[model samples]
Target: MRLTRGGKQNAKGAGQEMGGPDKEKLVPPAEGTAVPNGEETAVPKAAEPGPVTEEDRTRSEEGKSAGEGGQEETALAQEDGQRRPDESSLRSQLEAVQAELKSALDQAKEFEERAASLQAERDEWAEKAKIAYEQFLRARSDLDGFRKRTERDLEDRINRGKADLILALLEVLDNFDRALEAAQKTGSAQAEGVQGAYASADSSASGQALQSFIRGVQMIRRQFFETLAREGVEEIPSPVGKPMDPSLHDAVAAQEGGGEHGTVVAELRKGYLYKGMVLRPTRVKVIR
Candidate 1:
């Protein structure tokens, strides 16, 4: 096999050592002659340089790879020494970021809890307002009812008072009627029994006085009836000569008379109505 210059030198040095022969004492044997015992063979001259073989190319690649590997190892060691402080700085930055994140999380949790508490308070206030509104509605309804009832009661009391007062006044009216009838009868009888012109004149003067009194009484009755009319009190129609109605008249007595059966003959006492209600029933005599 062919070798490079360095490989050839190493091989020559090894051959010299193994041959144990000095180059000066070595002799070339003649052609076709046998060598003597213990004599070494002649060393041939080295061949000339030749084209590179596959083995030579492979060995050169191995040497270049070894040199590149050593350079890479040295660069890696330098990088490790330079990166120590940078790695420590990065670690500090990471720790600060983690602390900030933890603080933010805690604040968010506190805010969430506060928001929940506020919502609960709002709901409580809303419920209170709703209850108050319902109570107000109930109170308003009750007040309206009470007002209406009070008005009704006051109206009833007023009507009842008016009826009682008017009934008392009716008795006085009856007395006035009786007094006028008696006075008229007395005047007529006295006139019928008069004997002389002088007595007739005296009777006429007395009649004038009686007529004045009767006109005064009539004026008073007319005023009283006007006042009662203003207070919603009205006299019922006379039932005399008509069929007696139970609603308007009470039969005080029954008599045989020149009238239809169950017909009212006379009204003993006048009846009155107050505000469309019967205040008093007429007392009448009915024909049997």
Candidate 2:
């Protein structure tokens, strides 16, 4: 092989260093001469690679392709690594959102339960109020009835007091009537009895005086009866021939008379009725 001038000089210098022949004395070998084995001079030379072959070229191309493939694979791996972090962050966000949604749902359920409880309490109070109101109404009605009854009782008591006074007066009037009847039976001849201060009531002092006193008593009795009648007090009928009623008549005595049995034989005493009710029953004798 042809060498450059600088390369030849370097080879000669390396041969001198190993104590070999100089570069100028080195000649070409004789034709067909047998080169000695161990006596040949050594020449130091730089190591060189061998000539490139077709197979080596093919191997170089394949290696270049493989290197490019490795670079692409590394790039793809880096991209995947970058995307993994973002995906992880998104997953964490999704989990947080789901947890928040579940917590919110739970709180809502609790609020619903509380609302229902409050509603139940309100309904219970409403029921109690209704009961109290009904009781109050009933009490008010009872009070009203009691008040009316008390008013009626007070009125009845006042009327009974008036009736008692009238009844007392009627007893006095009854005594007066009996006195008048006895005086009439005495023939009005005793003028000394009724003509006390007024000795000359009329011209004839014997008959006129007592007769005038009797007329005055009769007028007083008539006035008393008219006043009693005006006040809704009336005497009960006690006819002798009528049937005796136990409700209106008190049978003081029973007698065997000619009339029908259980019939009124005689009216012993009169009765007074203030209203439709029996104030006093008529005293009568019934025929047995």
Index of the highest-lDDT prediction: 1
The runs of at least 3 residues in candidate 2 whose Cα sits more than 4 Å from the true structure, single-residue gaps closed, are: 1-89, 92-96, 116-163, 173-232
Model 2 lDDT, residue 136, Cα: 100
Per-candidate local distance difference test? 0.83, 0.78
TM-score of each: 0.61, 0.52
Candidate 1, residue 264: Cα displacement in angstroms equals 2.5
lDDT of residue 231 for candidate 1: 89
Q: Candidate 1: misplaced stretches above 4 Å?
A: 1-53, 63-116, 147-151, 154-159, 187-199, 256-261
lDDT, residue 176, model 1: 82
Q: Write the per-residue lDDT of candidate 2 for residues 98-216, one digit (tens) a residue.
A: 99999999999999999999999999999999999999999999999999999999979977987888778778878877978876876444544555675655435557556777888
Reference-based TM-score, model 2: 0.52
lDDT (0-100) at residue 166 of candidate 1?
88
